[model samples]
Target chain A: MVAISDLKKISEYEWEIPQSFRADMRVPVRFFVTRDLLEQALRDASLEQAVNAATLPGLVGHVTVMPDMHQGYGFPIGGVAATRYPQGVISPGAIGYDINCGVRLLGSQIEAEAAKPRLDVLATALNKYCPSGVGQGGALKLTERELDAICVEGAEWAKKRGYASDADLRRTEEGGRLEGADPAKVSPRAKQRGRPQIGTLGAGNHFIEVDVVEEIFDEEAAQVMGLHAGHLALQIHCGSRGFGHQICSDYVRAFQGAVKRYGIQLPDRELVCAPLDSPEGQDYLAAMRCAANYAFANRQLLAHWARQAFEETLAGGVKNWHLHQIYDIAHNMGKVEEHVVDGKKLKVCVHRKGATRAFGPGFPGLPAEYQKIGQPVLVPGSMGTASWVLVGTEGSMQRSFGSTCHGAGRTMSRSQAKKQIWGEDLRKELEGEGIHIRTGSLAGLAEEAPAAYKDVDAVVETVTGAGIARKVARLVPLVVVKG
Target chain B: MFTLTTTYQRNYKGSVTWGVGCDFQLEVLPFFVGIGKIRYTGKTMVTETGYREIEHTADWELEVWAPNLSSLLETAARGMYALAQMQLVDGERESREFEIPFGDRESLLVDFLAELLYLGEGEGLVMDEFSFTFDGNTLKVRAWGAPIKNQSKEIKAVTYHRLQIRETEFGLVVNLVFDV
Candidate 1:
């Protein structure tokens, strides 16, 4: 176990565990955390896992961990490791099981005061229109070939099918579609699993929440994103479903032998990896992008369903129930991005497990509207807490590889949360607080109790204080749909 | 788990009795009542097949042991279902047979459990009786189960994070990580 005192404090909100902490570690681990959050991380293996991640071959810069970091399977949840492209290794376990699991924010002009009377109806409509819970299927069905197209084209497929608009694609990361997605590299079993789950909001911590923008920190940025105080915003959080899981599983298993062939050694077997140039690595990347694209399409379809829900519930009730696209971003992914390392610009595969890409303004990928404001970084809090809307800063590009924290990271395990809180009671408490709750399983809801997570405000504060991200707006939940 | 085999004998006779010529790793935890038997620590003994819960902040991890590869797979599956809080209906029983290609014990274990998870997540199926016969890189599984009437949690998928089937003094011990 790593003690808090063992770290070399870089700043009040930053700490370092040098490579000397473990001999095998190729680079030091840099933490974006405050003292309190640092202590919260020490209680779990998040830091230790970060140290284990530091051992990945050919790691560049420090292995950066966000303030909301928590221990996951092999890598810490909020970790970012960039390796030299075509030379360094890519570990699927580090990218996580939920490939491209992400958050999508949609801004609306519907005022909370006007929608308050029908919030219950809107929540019910969302639950009814948008599928949730275990084994839930989407409204749309597709052939294996269509699913393959979605695997390669992502949200662009949705646009072609009229599920998405031009503006929606414009605001999404990588234009809601990643290039180099080769469905041939993906398995048939993975395709079969994905065929019927195109737009589902599958169970376990996944959700569609309706929130009212509670506050605005940066007026210009908030206006650019269409976030106004007292207005509603919708958040969709999920991933590639079973398709990504199987793809990741298939590769993680195949890479076990790859590590031996590549002569790479690691401390954790869960951290199994392949050389970036190897066939195993190239195949996994190609397949991972398929899952990534699939996820993008899934969220796009869910957002379309959400718009339908809004129209069905509030079309006649309000003048504008229309939800406009703010931005969509993936929290779990491995992208080949250019960053200056040791004053040398290099294309490195940035593996962000539970972190957000927070590119500063002036990046070429940004839409024309957001070129001056930087990329939007959505950091959702736990149920009943405040979610945040931030933008990347130049400092993030310089230090953290253009990434920020993902959410109010879990402070307790699911078992611990279940043991400590009752789902029914938590639901009641949240209901009492004016947050409508719709969940598939009461036990599942109990496991996601707000008390189980760290303070999102403090987490946001740390990153903003570290100058990696800048705050734009804050949101408070009005209705939450969980599975 | 000793009780696991005993339960298999009581609940699924055909499966526990199939494949007679295989060594059984017989050690059971203290009344292994689902995931409740686990300690809230990272290193708590499940006490069945030397399987124990390893503390993970987000996902679930179990360290399982057996005398050989086959027993190790069984113990790990038992541990996994326990964590998911899987249960079956009493009157409506069902069974399914599966033929899955395997490369090694690690991949075989992942693919096998992934199949079970798919059944549960897709069709609400749960099984008590299971028979696995491995011929080279193939595993033929004959399983008896019922629709999952009660499941407290749902695991997203099984992962290969440091998954290894090792030969130890007592048996083959390995740690499995499940993405929840």
Candidate 2:
């Protein structure tokens, strides 16, 4: 474990672990958190993990971890690193197992008051229309040919099928499709696992929430996102499903040797990497993009299903259900982006594992509609807690390469949470808080109890405090559907 | 045929059972270190739906049995390198020490193995053999190997999801489910 004393206080919200601490480190390690939260984060080896990530080959700037950072497989969740493009190494572990495991938010026309009475009906419709749960399969089953298309085109595939709108595709990161997705690079087993799971929410912390926009902090930004105070909204949190998981697993195992071939010495095995220009690195990146596209399509289809469920359950053909895609962003992904580093316009592979891309205004990626307001950052809170909507700031690009916190990070482990809370009782407690939940298993529910996480409000406070992302609105959940 | 029942239960989550058919009752863990017993049977392997099916690996492959999922996974991990005739060294040599941390249990196991590989390659420690103790979620293990000799398989970092280690009445069953 890295001693807390080794952490140099950079600011009230920033702490740094200098590269001098480790000889192999290419960059320093920086963490964003409040003093109290910093203490909690240190309870586990997440800081150590962050420090270890700093030692990867070709890393640039400091290995920056967001406030939501937690111990993850190879890299800590909410971790960010920008490695020199082409020559910099890419670690499958750094990208994570659930590749493109991200959150997408949709805003509807219905107001909170009007939607409250019919919450149960909406929840039931969503649960039925959107398949969720462990080992659950979706209604749409794709053949190998179609699956390959889905992997390649991502949201574009959904748009072609009329499941997505042009506007929806425009607002998504990378226009909802990343470049260089080579399906052939994805193994058959990974394809097999993904073939049946599209449009389904797999188990473990993945959820679909029906929330009411409680408050709008930035009116101009809210208007651009079609979000208003009291507007009913839907937030879908999932990934490329078994497909992404398998792809990452397959590559992480494959790259174990690439580290040696490249003569790279990492502080942790989880940071195993291959040079971006190398054949192995190129193949893994391609495969990772396939998973990213799959996740985009997966969420797009879920949105379609959600709209259908609303139309079926409510009157007026659910015309009141104006579910506009606010924005979809990839949190766990590595993208080759051009950024200014040390007064040089250098291309780098920015890996945002369990972190969100917070591109500010004037970036070319956003649709014309959102170009003025900047990227819509979705920060989903813990179950039964308040989530937030933030917009990227110019300060973000200058500082953390246009990246920000992903969600309310965890404060406790699953076991620790389970030992302290009961599944049945926790259900009752959430319901008492006026949040309705339907879960596949009670134990899973207990493991995800709100107390198991840090306060979303506080985490958001740190980001806004640091000026990386500015608050736009706050969302309070009315009903939740968990897988 | 022998009937193998693998059960997984979370104190808070649901439990699942997977059945495999083999012809043997393996000696459970704590019974022996390297070898275990298997009673051969003639019955067929059954699926969750109760339909019998044919399997090749279970029918003829050699499996090292343990009592729990951790040991099962450990030995399975060991089995991968053991096949290479990797030699074990005494833990007496005081070498570089580092901490391996993971997000979850399965990733923890992967990190454990990766640590051994790193020692073998990075620090010049030839890791041919190792043993581990699971204290809750943390693992502390002793590994043996000569100084870094040459490259073996490039073992990357471990993952956390879809990891399975099951205990059965017959013996321990571990699934080497890798993301890669």
Candidate 3:
């Protein structure tokens, strides 16, 4: 176990574990956490896993962990590591099983005060329109050919099909489509799985929630993102479903042999990886992008259905009831990009697992309106709490590869949470607080009880204090749909 | 369940035993080492085939011990269904079979469970009876079930995260971690 005494403190919000602490580590491990949260992380394997991640080959800079870090299987949940491109290594486990599992925020002009009376109706409509729960299919059924197109076209496929608008595509990350996605690289079993789950919200912590913008910290940034105080916004949190799962599983299993072929050694078998320039790595990257694009289209379609739900519930009740896309960003992904480290511009593959990309101002990827500001970083809190909206800063680019925390990370195990919290009682409590709750399973609900996670406000404070991200707005949930 | 003598067995304190009693198996390496042949129970080794839920921090983990590989696979399937809270329908039984080319043992394990998940989600079908046969690296699975009448959870994927299939002193032991 790693003791706190071994850590080299950099600042109140930053700390480091030097590479010399572990003989195999290629780079040091950096911690973006408060002292309190660091204590919590010490109780679990999050920090140790972050240290393990530092051992990956060709790692550049530090293995940066966000404040909302938690213990996961191969990699810590809120981890970001960049590897030099071409020859650098990419670990499928580092990217995660749910490829492109992301959050999409849609801002609306509908006033929360005016829509209060119909909150339950809106929740029901959203649940009815968005097919959620275990084994549930989505609103649209696609053929193999169409699924192939989505692998390449992403949200643009949705746009052409009238499920998305030009403005919606503009605000999305990479215009909601990744380049060089090859459907041929994705396996047939993945295609079979992807065919049926286009807009569905699969089970386990994935959710669709309606919130009211509680407050705005950056007025100009909020206005540019269309976030208004006391107005309604919707957040859809899901991923590539089984398609990405199979792809990752396939590549990870295949890479077991690849690691042997490449003559690379790791502490954990789950951290199996290959050089980016290798044939195996190229194939996995291509397949991964297919899953990534598929996820973009999945969220885009979900956004369309969400819009439909809003219109059905609030049409004629309010002057306008449309949900415009704020931005869609992947928390789990591997992106190839150029970044400056020590005044050297190098291309690298940034693997962010349960961490959001927070590109600072003037990157040229942002929509014109957001160029002055930075990329929107959506940090969802636990259910029935305040979710934060933040943007990247220059410090993020310099120190952490432009990535930040993902959510109020889990502090308790699911078993512990379920044992301590009753699902029925949790539902009643949230309902009493005027938060409309729709869930598929009570047991799952108990597992995700708000008490199971860390303090979201404190996590945001750490990131903003560290100068990695800037807070823009805070949101309070009115309705939550979970599967 | 029939006990196969082909697998290894250990006698401890003159009792039969099988199960992964940990709430969550520690990291991957120590899990197998920590519990191998060093039976904590003063009484041990019942020689029956069964499975148990081990504690996992984020996802569901299961440990299955049997007298052989086929029975271990069966027990692992049952454990997975139990983890997902799968329930079957009355009145009708549905059957599906999988005959596929095999790779490694771990890959075979993941593919088997993934097939079951695919059936459960895509067609609402599940398994009831089990027959796993291997012939020249070809796996044949024959099973029966009906459309899922009720289910509480969904497993996103069967992962290779610290997956280990062991031929231990207590027959064949396999630990599986699932992504939910």
User: Candidate 3's error at A110, in angstroms?
Assistant: 1.7
- Give lDDT tens digits, candidate 3, residues A271-303: 899999999999999999999999999999989
Where does model 1 exceed 4 Å of error?
Answer: B1-55, B63-68, B90-94, B99-104, B122-124, B136-139, B150-152, B162-173
In TM-score terms, candidate 2 sits at 0.77
lDDT per residue as tens, model 3, B1-180: 332222122211122334433322222321111121232222122335655556666777777778787787777777787667676777677778888568777778887887888888778876867887888889999988777777788887787766778886557788787888
What would the per-residue lDDT of candidate 2 be over residues B31-54, giving only the tens digit for each residue? 111101211223323222111111
Model 2 agreement with the true structure over A388-452: per-residue lDDT tens digits: 99999887887788899999887775535555677789889888887878887676677678898
| Residue A449 displacement in candidate 3 (angstroms) | 1.0
For candidate 3, give the lDDT of residue A30: 95
Q: Model 2 segments beyond 4 Å from truth?
A: A317-319, B1-71, B74-180
- Residue A325 of model 3 has an lDDT of 88
Docking class of 3: acceptable
lDDT of 1 by residue, A338-455 (tens): 9999899999999999999999999879999999999999999999899999999999999899999999999987766776777888989999999998998887887788888999
- Count: clashes, candidate 2: 27
- Model with the higher TM-score, candidate 2 or 3: 3
Off by over 4 Å in 3: B1-47, B99-104
Report lDDT (Cα) of residue A63, candidate 2: 91
Docking class of 2: incorrect
lDDT of 3: 0.86
Model 1 chain A — which ten-residue stretch has the worst lDDT? A413-422
Against the native complex, each candidate's DockQ, computed on alpha carbons, is 0.44, 0.05, 0.32
